[model samples]
Target: MIVHTAEVVRYVTAPAVTFEPLRDGASRGLLDHYLATLAVATGPVGLTRMIASTADMTARLLDFAPDALRRIGADAIIADSAEPSGPIIAQHLGVPYVISVTGLPLLEEENVPPPFVGWRYRSDRLGRFRNRGGYRVSHFLMRPIASTLHRRRLTWGIKDADQPLAYVAQCPRILDYDRQNLPPNFHYGSPWRNSPAPLLDPPNGDKPLIFCSLGSLQGARKKLFAIMAKACAEIGARAVIGHGGGLTPEEEASLPGNPLVRAFWPQETLLRLCSAAVLHGGFNTVLDALAAKVPIVAVPIAFEQPGTAARLAHFRVARVISPQRLSVATLVKALEEVVHDPTYRDMASRLSVAMEAGGGASGAAVIVDAALSKLP
Candidate 1:
């Protein structure tokens, strides 16, 4: 419930901006540039932009605190894990806060491998050494964001308390909202539950149902979705595509029809009917596919997607095809392999069981109760 209450855009903003569109109104090559280097290459421009964005959003959120308190009168704050805003705002308002993470538990433990580094979880000395230094260096690069948050706090006349890590580490409760075919042992967090999706009647019988979408921001990639539509058509599967991006008449017209393309679709409800999915590997989409026992053809574009794609492939429930290498032929081939192979489905089902056992929403309630009881 600790969500950004931005009207209309609440569903879009989170841990970070999706590589869906350009920030400066420059559209054509923004995604291309991001996919080329933003995956692993963090540079001055990227870091500066990241810091500026987070700082600006945090201030905006803080601006709303007074109104939010008057309207909701909530006792505590539940913050998204992407930015330090939650903790900062909670501290400013004198309330206890718990973070709800939707991605891998990278910062939860020192031995847990960093996601951006693209390392597998290994307990060996070499792995631990790498993880330790890797986390430190990663956080070092994040110093600018931290500095910005501090400066904003001072501007608001609040005393600084070195609250970033203290806020994260001292969070008596952390809720990981997803399980994406990973080892159950590494799955930390109080589980949040999902309702069983209402199944849809497939338009075509016996054809593999492939649900395709790039999610919130990237859904605007008309070209990529068009390619996916063609691939699905080539393979003769009934594809239902959700265009999360608000494509106008002209842009939507170019999308292929063999795959049903719509401005939007109820993704959770739709996944119930899918045999396989072609996705940009967003966190929610991955978890939904795992829950539905659907194998994935992961085409990671940016953010934590590449890391998620690596893990999914390592788990054998997915085949990774980087956007740079994405072609109709390659996309069709990967989907073919995943659809025909029983192994991916079996593994995906196993993950689904683990995910349910982890106690989705109910587990989160228990943690929140404990956190509250600990207070005074």
Candidate 2:
């Protein structure tokens, strides 16, 4: 059974999956504000606001989720990394839970920067110092969430050690920086997605195809989509844009290259035919593009996107551009490099092989089952 927000019901199409929506009045509005904050957040200030909003949402969840889960009689909980209330609620219900990191994992190491930063992995003394500083800032921003969790734990008589039974991330270990301190229960799993159905009629065009997406949250940035469309046109490629229902009909009609614009699409199907991709550096999209052996031009906007883009650059599979510096000219240059160079595609192919070996959702399910088996 899935305990989610009411808005999530539309996406829950699996026949066997049952869901219960948290009856919190403030959850939707708070979540909207959080996403809005992430769309334009640049540094510490924006991150603080995001954390504050999350704390507010967590409080709401704490007020209602325990009762909801009790009513449903959930034996075990699988929680998204973004939801901090999950572990606390699981403890309140005395149920084993798993942490599902659908995006970049937030684990901190001295040699690796926090997930919010775009800094590359560095192991040298100065690099470690920089990473430590970044983590300090991250901790500072997360204080609100920490305080909320602490208060709730105290109220519910839960321990400070709110550890999950298993911590599974969709990020392939090969794509992440070396980590010597991962928890024993942590597993690097592949992207969680169903097999793609064959496209009834694949796109037919002489021009090299480029897939562009900003993901669901930031897909409403019409100006950014315009730049992507213009850049693709300048490079003599066809751009297929998926805005995730974030665009209006009139706005979609104005994009350059006479691009095909849609609210959603079969991403994997289209990506298999593309030479390169333009993205907001969302982890899932990056994984999908790599799985399809497509190189990327990443314009990271907020959240863990910059960190994901940094990893892509580290692997030489993508060119990372800051959203602040994004423009038709800059995007065109990045696209040209990724499209014309074979090295990017080659590296992506290598990672694709590694991801296949990492065992996708099935591998994660194995870890989860093992964890739950040990529970009393």
Candidate 3:
């Protein structure tokens, strides 16, 4: 497994798995700054800043990954969709590669809005025009990474070919907006997990339990946690917060409602016990929540979060409150509505069933095997 030095500590690899750390890359500080920038940025400007922040990291991956992968004699590559360099490196190395959509799939379709924006899915001519315009803007913003890839491809004497052997997303088709232009090789898969997570005992008390998580990347927002806690408290719900090591002990203690705030927890286990979830629209957590048949209240902060939240709303499984507009009262209203309404729970349950039918990691593996089988 190849990953950044900072992320190496997060994984618990099996005996057969070896982690190859990419060193001297983006520092923790730079990554934090990038996340911070995205917290306040929105629209096309936010997208531009996001691409600009990752320019150096993209260059480093292009410089290091091809040689490292070649040395390892890797026969096939499974590249994260978020990392564009992966497909390029595989092309340069002449290896078959599969693109894994860990977050929202970045595939461009005229009827689908770009993943960064919260625009609703539209199939009309005007909507298609708008969607195309969004892609053009995204393509323009991506020139920095594109330039790096072009230079590397030239140096390696490889022609431009970014298409993957297969594409699998960590989302079920029902959770996403309808897409008419997906590649034939594209497959909708389930969230990757080793096994079915065992359900945990619900927290003691009759107060409706609500799981609140901002995921690892955006968990550091103390104010957001505080707002969620306050809203849950007002709604007479117990807020179980997993901030992913983002909060200091003092900060955690300072949150309202004396909410059960931990740096980490068995999220799937907690979701099973919760009546509703308050999320930052992180895809993995959203999947976990839906899998538990729990309704949601989404506060989208950055990246493809808004788009994810929009889908949740489109399906009537969640209520979205943009971070810029989020507050204790707004969250309280969303939380109460989701918890008390049977429709939200019903929709979530339906999606959960659909998600299971699509199959999880095992289904994704089958697609990968088939793709590789087609390779020479």
With a 3 Å backbone cut-off (N, CA, C), the pairs that clash in candidate 1 are: 191-360, 192-360, 192-361, 193-360, 193-361
Q: Which candidate is the best by lDDT?
A: 2
Q: Quick one: ranking by TM-score, best first?
A: 2, 3, 1
Give the higher-TM-score candidate: 1 or 2: 2
Instruction: Indicate the residue-level lDDT of 247 in model 3.
Output: 95
Q: Is candidate 1 or candidate 3 better by lDDT?
A: 3
Model 3 TM-score (2 dp)? 0.92
**What lDDT is obtained when candidate 3 is compared to the true structure?**
0.84
Count of steric clashes across candidates, in order: 5, 0, 0
Model 3 over residues 1-376: C-alpha lDDT tens digits?
Answer: 6544355544646665676655555566655676666555556787677677677677877877666676667899999988778887888777889999988878888888999778887789998999899999878878988888788888888876868889998888888788888888889877887665564554788888899999887778899999999999998988999998889999999999969888988888788889999998999999999999999998887878889998999999999998889998899888889988899999999999998888788889899999899876
Best by TM-score: 2
**Residue pairs in steric clash, candidate 2?**
none
> Per-residue error at 115 for model 3, in Å?
0.6
Cα RMSD to the true fold for all candidates: 7.4, 1.9, 2.5
- Every candidate's lDDT: 0.66, 0.86, 0.84
- Which 10 consecutive positions of candidate 1 have the poorest summed lDDT? 165-174
Candidate 1 lDDT over 1-376, as tens digits, reads: 2334333233453454331211222334433443333333334676556555555555556666545554556678767677566777777777767666666544535555566645666667886798789878867867767776777688766786423211121111221223334323232542243455454654557776799888766676778888898898889887788877546677777778466767667676777788899988777778878877899998877667777777788778899897778989999899999999999999888777776666566666566567667778
